[model samples]
Target: MAGMKKLLIALMMAVAAPTHAEVFAKGADIGWLPQMEATGYKFYDSDGKEEDCFRILKDHGINTIRLRTWVHPSNDRASGHNSKDETVAMALRAQRWGMRVMIDFHYSDSWADPQQQRKPAAWEGHDFPQLLDDVYNYTHEVMQALKQAGVTPEWVQVGNETRTGMIYPEGHTDNWPQLAQLINRGYDAIKAVSPSSKVVLHLDRGNDNAWFRTWFDNAQKYGAKYDVIGMSYYPFWLDGRPDYSESISDLGANLNDMAARYDKEVMVVEVGGVDTEPQNTYDMLLAVQRKVADVPGGKGLGVIYWEPQGARSWSHYELSAWGADGRPTKAMEAFRVKLGDK
Candidate 1:
């Protein structure tokens, strides 16, 4: 009777576990692909043949593309350039390429990060309950649109790099219960529109295991339902150095620890390589791949490179590996390389 009861309890526990888990995602944020192509930014293959940006990334073994969506982004010339329409269009192209897609919701009119979590202009002056309704309706609308387009995302981040929280002081960590309520509402909306989509709770500083523990513990305490733990790992610039020799090792350890502690699939949702040291970028990416793939209990989802094609333009994001000829640098070899067991 005791053995039978134990088996029943184990089965019940298994049934209670979260069902969705993100698979290993070799991804890149090519949200700029449409805009770049629109501007005549022709990308070339490694064979020196002109091709579309999506095909080039496909050639490099990228299996997924991450795109960001802002709720009614403004054209105020402040770099808040993304829109839901662009993301939906990008998702269509990624689907055409047989690539999985992840949509990061900024939950703001513009960027929402650790330092700033600005509420959308439309949501301003709303009370907490009204704000929750706004998040739910907006999230549901985005997912519903994707569902209509037949390009529903495989993963949807509730907010982008939301370290402090999302949607300003109302949704910030200072108000944990409110933040949890907002995040939960977003989660409910995503599931309502597309049950297959896995929800991600994203934060910056992937190497900082301590911060992740505190934030997630508080989240669990407040009853936030999420599937994946997405983190940003920008070792080169984020750590105030060009050499990432020591940083990479610490990063790997942190990834492992986060997986073991949280029992949720972890992903480096945003990463980058420096222009000056593309080789270092390659090494760092390779290390991240191997490390994430080695997470305890096989809970690592994978890493996504942030804007690997932003080079040789007026934008001139220094971390991009793209060259003047509109092809990826040698550092992109990281995506193509094979990894052995760690």
Candidate 2:
């Protein structure tokens, strides 16, 4: 009788435990959407009918929206309009559309990437210690504002494409300890406000395993706290302008290796192909999605197309998936097919 009762209890406990549903995130970094709309750019569906950009993105099967926030952004058409207020508003809009949000903190007034990670002008005179405070305070403030607005981001990136490190000389990779300190500060602030949000440490060159290994090895040594590893894969920007075919497999290997090596989740936070070549871009997107989904233990989080809705004519960016007709090209369709679908 005692043994039968114990088995029954165990079965009841198992039945009561919640099951974890695996959701493969289909994301689009439409950070430029607000600026594009503000400047009178309209988005159309495949049928040539004008529609709200969010609706069109949903139709393309985008379940997550990524937005970038800049400190003291200028009013310039191209270089501006990602201020904190703008970010919060966009997050709210995304939530209304039933989409998950990813907050990308550029820590700059403009673009922050591998080529340049300039410090915001407000923190120009701060010493290293003060810089750490700046990161924590700014991150906490943004997170608090989002929380107050009932917007909880699914993922928060502490810095953009920091292969060389962010905040210039102070937080540069040359100074690993200081960079790690800065990253931890941001991480702490984010967790304090939104404990459930996963913090991402992002870098460019998703296909370069050696670079990722070295960089992440140093990050580990310095005790940087991050929940996910984010990467940017842009074959169009490669030195020889290689086709996606040349580097896609390498990207897949790197994603798998990062998950297994680091024991953490991995995501292709940014990826794009030539906008003019929609069919090729479509094929590349499908391949990239497959590579990410193939990560063992389901640690492959998601793939986000950077600025897919930012039509080339408006942004003058060749990597966008939208065309001059204000409609998303066939490449956007790649997102419509989710993982595990036939």
The per-model lDDT (C-alpha) reads 0.84, 0.93
For residue 228, give model 1's deviation from the true position in Å.
0.7
lDDT for each residue of candidate 1 in 165-207, tens digit (9 for 90 to 100): 8888888899999999999999999999999898999988887
- Predicted candidate 1, C-alpha RMSD: 7.3
The candidate that achieves the highest TM-score relative to the unseen native structure: 2
lDDT: worst 10-residue window of model 2: 16-25
| Candidate 2 wrongly placed segments (more than 4 Å) | 1-21
TM-scores for every candidate against the unseen true structure: 0.90, 0.94
